[model samples]
Target chain A: MVELKVDQDKCLGCGNCVVACPVNGSISPETAGGHGPKTEDVIMMVENGVIKLFNEDKCTRCGTCPLFCPTDAIFLE
Target chain B: MVTNTKEVKGKDICVQRISPEEKRELAYKDDVCIGCGICAKICPTEAIELGEIGAIERTGVDESKISIDEAKCVLCGMCSSACPVDALDLKLDEKSIKDMAEYPQLIKSAEISDDLCIYCKACETACPRDAITIARILPERSKLVTGEIEIDKDTCISCGICEEMCPADAIEMEHHEPTSSDPTVSSDITVNKDKCVYCLICRKSCPVDAIKAVCRSCSYGDYDLNPEDSETTGSSFIDEEACVNCGWCQEICPVDAATVEKAFEGELTIDQDTCEACGACVEICPCNVLSFPEAEFGEQSDKVQADETYCIYCGACENVCPVEAIDVKRTAVKHTPTKSKSWEKQLSELKT
Candidate 1:
C-alpha cells in the first residue's frame, strides 16, 4: 500500500488533480454514474483553496495526483 | 588648522574650508528639489538623510530637509539619476540610468513596476524557483498595500519567465539588459474546467490522440450478480501526461472550455489571394458567424468576414471547405447562441 500525503499549505486549489484522476472514487456518487462507478468512498476533494483527502484507503496509487499538482504539494510514500 | 564652514546662498549651498588655501565646493540646489526621496531611497552608502516637516508636506512637497554626508558619498550619482524632481545636483557627468542598465552585473533579480501592475498572479505561477510572493490586498484596505509583490533575489535565477508570464507587462527582469529580441512570444493553451460540459467531441477530434476520455464502468458491489441484471455506471478523465498541448481540443470543444492565448499577435488569418469564395465555409458554419460580400459577375473570390464573438472555433467549416483557403490558427472557442426563430419560440414558452 502506498502512503499519500497532501501539504495543505502548498495546495493552490487549481483542481487539476481532480480533473486528471482516472478513478471514480474522487467523485460523488450522484455525479459518478455518467463518468465512472458510483461508490460511497471518495479519495480526494477540493475546498477553500486546498485539496483534501477524503478516503486514503480508496486511492489506487496511480501517482497521477502528484504529477498534475502544479505546486508539487502532494507526495507519495 | 582647517575648519569647514557651510553657507546657504538662496538655492545653492556652498561648502568652504578656511586654511592657507580656500577651496569652494558646491553641493545640491534646493530650488529644483521636490523632496521625492528617490535619491535617499536608492543611495547604496546611505549618505543622504531626508527629514520630514509636516503632514501636508509628506506628499510630494519639498518641505523635508536633506542632509548629505560628504564622507559617505560614493559619487556614484545613482541618487541623482533616480531623483524624479532633478533636485540632486551631484556634478557627475552621466545620463539617468534608463531601466537599470548596469543592473545585470550589479543586481540579479526581478522587479515589478507598481504603476503598470494589475496584481495578476501569472508571474507567480510561471516562476519555477518559487521566488515571487504576491500578497493580495483585501478589497476594503487596498490602499494600504498597493504594491505588495516581493521577490527573493537570492532564489531568483533571473530566467525572465516572470516577465514573459506577466499579462499586464509589469514584471521586469532587471538583470537582463533590454534588447530588441527580449520580448518573448509565449503561446499557451488553457482549459476553463467550469465551462466544460464533458462533451467528448474534443477527445475524439484530437489528431495526436493526446486527449483520453476514460469511462469507468462497474457494477454496484455485486460480483456474483448476473451480467444482464447488473447496472453499469461510468466517468470521464483527461490524461495530462498524454496531452501534447496542440490545442485541437480547444478548437473542437463545443463550449468555452479550452482556450489558446495568442497575445494579440493575430496568428489566424484568411489568405485573400488563394480564397476561391465558393461560400462553402459560410454555408457550413453552424453559428452563421462567417459571411462574404456578394461577388460581381467575373469575380471568383471575395473576402470572408468572421464574427469573432459568435465563433465557437469547432473547425467544422475549415474541415468542409474544398479549396483549403481558410487558415484559422485556432486561438479561442466560445459557445454563444444566436437568436433564431426556434430559439425565440423556446424562450417565449419558458417565460410562461
Candidate 2:
C-alpha cells in the first residue's frame, strides 16, 4: 500500500505524469463530479489546472509518475 | 545399434545412434544464420559442432551449417534458445518447440541481427559483463555496415542489458530468460513540439552537440522594455551576419523567446534629432565603443556618438537607455561631427 500527494503550487500542469504512468485509467482530467474510482481504485486527476490524487487505493506503487514529473510536484509515501 | 565409430586415445567413439524413444533432432535454417556460432557454443551437451568456413566450403555445404549428433543430445533445448536469429529449431516427442521459453541460470552468449542493427553502440556501453565486441568489418566502407557485433559465450553472463539498451531492438538474448527484474523499462527525454517556445536554452546548456535550434526572427532579441515598442524605438536588433549562434541571448532571456538564427546585419547608430545627450550608453558599454565628445563653453552637448568599428553589437547599451534615443539597426545613418577643433578652442579661450 502507498500514498500519493500532489503539490498544487508546484505543478505546472504539463501532464508529463499522465503520459508516464504505466497503468491505464490511473491519471486523467478531472470531471464536473470529480473522478469516480475505477476498477483500480487509485486515480490521479487534473482539477482547476492542477493535478490531484482522486483515490489512493488502486495504485500499484510503481512510482513511475513521480520519476517523470519535471517539476517534482508529485510525491509518493 | 551404434555406428560411425572413430578411435580416439585407443577408445572407440560412437558418433551415431538409433533409438525410438530417445530420438531428438535439431534443425538449422542455412539462409538466416550469419555464421556467428552462438548456438553451437551454448549447447550444454556439445551435440552441435560448428565447422570452420574453409572446411564447410570443401565439404560442399553452407559455411554456417552446424552438425548435430542426435545420440549426444539431451533435448535440453539450449541451442535453439540461444540462436539470435530463430535459425535453429529443436524437436522433442515429434513436436517442434515453437517458443524458446526458458530462463536458464547462466546466459553463455547473446547475438545481434546485422540486417536490423543500426550500430548505435548503446549495447556496447550497456553491457555489464564486457563480453560484447563490436568491430568494423571494413573501415573504408560505409559506417552503417562497418559495425559487426559479436559476443563471447565463454565470458557472457546473460545479463540481458544489451537487449534492453538496443535503440533499434536488434539484439536477442539467449538461454537466460528476461525477468521482471531485468530492467525492461527504459527512460527517454521527450519534448512536446507544440508547447516548445524555441528559446534554445536547452541547446546552450547541452554538453553534446545533440540539440540544434535556429531562430530567424527578432523574437530572440533582448530588450529591457516592451517588445511592441521595437519598431518605434529600434532599441534592439540582432545582426545575424555578425552573430555566431552562441545562444548567449537565449540563456539570458526571461520570456524564453530568444533564438539564434540568420537575420540582417546591423550597425550601431545614434539619432541626432532625438538625442538627449544621456551618458547611460557610454557608461554601460563593455567595449567602450560609445563616447561623448567634450563640449566647450557656449557649445551645445546634445548628442552621443558610437565608434562603429569598435562596437561588438551586444545591445547592452540599447536596453539600458531610459529614452529610446539610440537605434541599433542596419539602415540608421552614421553620425557626423558638427563641431570643429579650432571653433571649440576659440570659444573656450573667450569663456576663460
DockQ each: 0.01, 0.01
Candidate 2, residue B184: the lDDT equals 32
For model 1, state the Cα shift of residue B13 in Å: 3.7
Residue-by-residue lDDT tens digits, candidate 1, B201-230:
434444444343321222232343344433
Q: Tell the DockQ for candidate 1.
A: 0.01
lDDT of 1: 0.44
Candidate 1 chain B: worst-modelled 10 consecutive residues by lDDT: B53-62
Per-residue lDDT tens digits for candidate 2, residues A1-77, read 13456788999876665544433232231221133323333366555688776565644443456766888798664
Q: What is the C-alpha lDDT of each candidate?
A: 0.44, 0.44
